[model samples]
Target: MRLRSLLFAPGDRPERFEKALASGADAVILDLEDSVAPLNKPKARENVHEFVLHHAGETALLIRINPLTSPEFEDDLAALSGLHPFAIVLPKAEGAASVLKLAGSLASAIPILPIATETPSAIFEIGSYRDVSTSLCGLTWGAEDLPAAMGATTARRTDGRYTPPYELARSLTLFAAHAAAVPAIDTVYPDFRDLNGLRAYVGRARRDGFSGQMAIHPSQVEVINHAFTPDASEIAWAEKVAAAFAARPDAGVIQLDGRMLDLPHLKLAIRILDVAGR
Candidate 1:
């Protein structure tokens, strides 16, 4: 549940599942969607089912199912019904209605981590998930498919940045997740070989209020985890804020270490402690 870094492993490559588990990622996603070839869909689903049944209790596992409209959806659901992985990643999710429909169809009560703002329509409907927060654990965005869906040249800029439109989508998804009281997870960095780029990306995400990030490769996990975790300075500040607030519970504001602390500052201190505990 404390997802600092969630790595993806292709469902067809069942042999890599254990390797991914041992890679020190907080979670591992068995991808049945984009990572699997079209011809291997059936095999991928079967392998995921077998993997789930065999390793359900060993690690935090999530299955990234194909889009809802895909022909493989029903079988995907059927294969996962009894296995009960930690959660399901609903790709290309457009709104709360889709999440509700899927929740209603499932025999088990698994929490969903929906890529809520992937397509253009999805960006418009991101707010709708607030009404169905009970069925969700988190919300994330995807940059890869949305631009292609809209016939855009690219989601990332020439300088390896997200264009303004995609940036808006990412920020909106972050706000929507917080509004729903669920964790906001940033999308993958795509450039698996660029460790420096990945570190900078993860740092930006943590600073921008994302609780965690999705990782495309195992090598990216440590950097993401380090970025998201509270550093020593942060822990010291949080402790000071907590002490100040606790010592002056009835005061509206208190000055601490040459700075004024208020309710907002106290709340952030508590959050830091909570995350640190995790």
Candidate 2:
């Protein structure tokens, strides 16, 4: 799927689910984890299950289950078994082994999107997913939980950027996703009201090779989508490059618009076309 923006909706709030669907996000994440309180976990799961049963084939749906170690994990899995979301977002994932363990438990073939570096162990094991790429759809990281897990006073800098350690974690997650041959999804922007900041952050993520971003609110979806989609100029350039390469397949390197284009540049041009088509 062309996942430029994946928006979140609290699973317990079924009233908001339809609104989230209409928010223009490429995917919707029904959150049954941190968004729901301990007492409300069961109800949240039910709401999500019902919603999925009714709308499973309509839109790309994802469920964010609580961490496997939490009391709610098994119930979450049991409740969601037959509904079959597009993918499950496993929080606090420490490595590929964790993903494999979950995949082994599932009765169906559901791809996984792991929050790969939300803990110290997760950061250390980022490279482990390279071997488990078949079952993984993407790799994402969360800053809010990791810093708390690490006992850090702050996850963000005074200038609103991620702290240095968190920045490293984000970079590692991006690299791990690429190594695993899956999309790299940036974490939520947090400040739903800061559209300018969200745009800048999404632009930076796209520039850094991230395929998409998570949105905490519906308002952020459009910004993320626009930031990731190939613009008119980009599409034009990709088309020209592709045509030039096709015309001279025998030449390993060809001159395009006075610039020497090599195999790697041609490959990138093709990728841009693929993404634009998506």
Candidate with the greatest lDDT versus the true structure: 2
Question: How displaced is residue 233 in candidate 1, in Å?
Answer: 1.8
Task: Score every model by TM-score.
Answer: 0.98, 0.97
- Give the C-alpha lDDT of model 2: 0.91
Query: CA lDDT of 156 in candidate 1?
Result: 86
- lDDT for residue 125 in candidate 1, whole number 0-100: 94
* lDDT of candidate 1 over 8-108, digit per residue (tens): 99999998999899988988999999999989989999999989998889878999998899998898887786788888999999899889988887898
Quick one: best TM-score, which candidate?
A: 1
**Distance (Å) between predicted and true CA of 183, model 2?**
1.0
Inter-residue clash pairs, candidate 1: none
Model 1 lowest lDDT segment of ten: 75-84
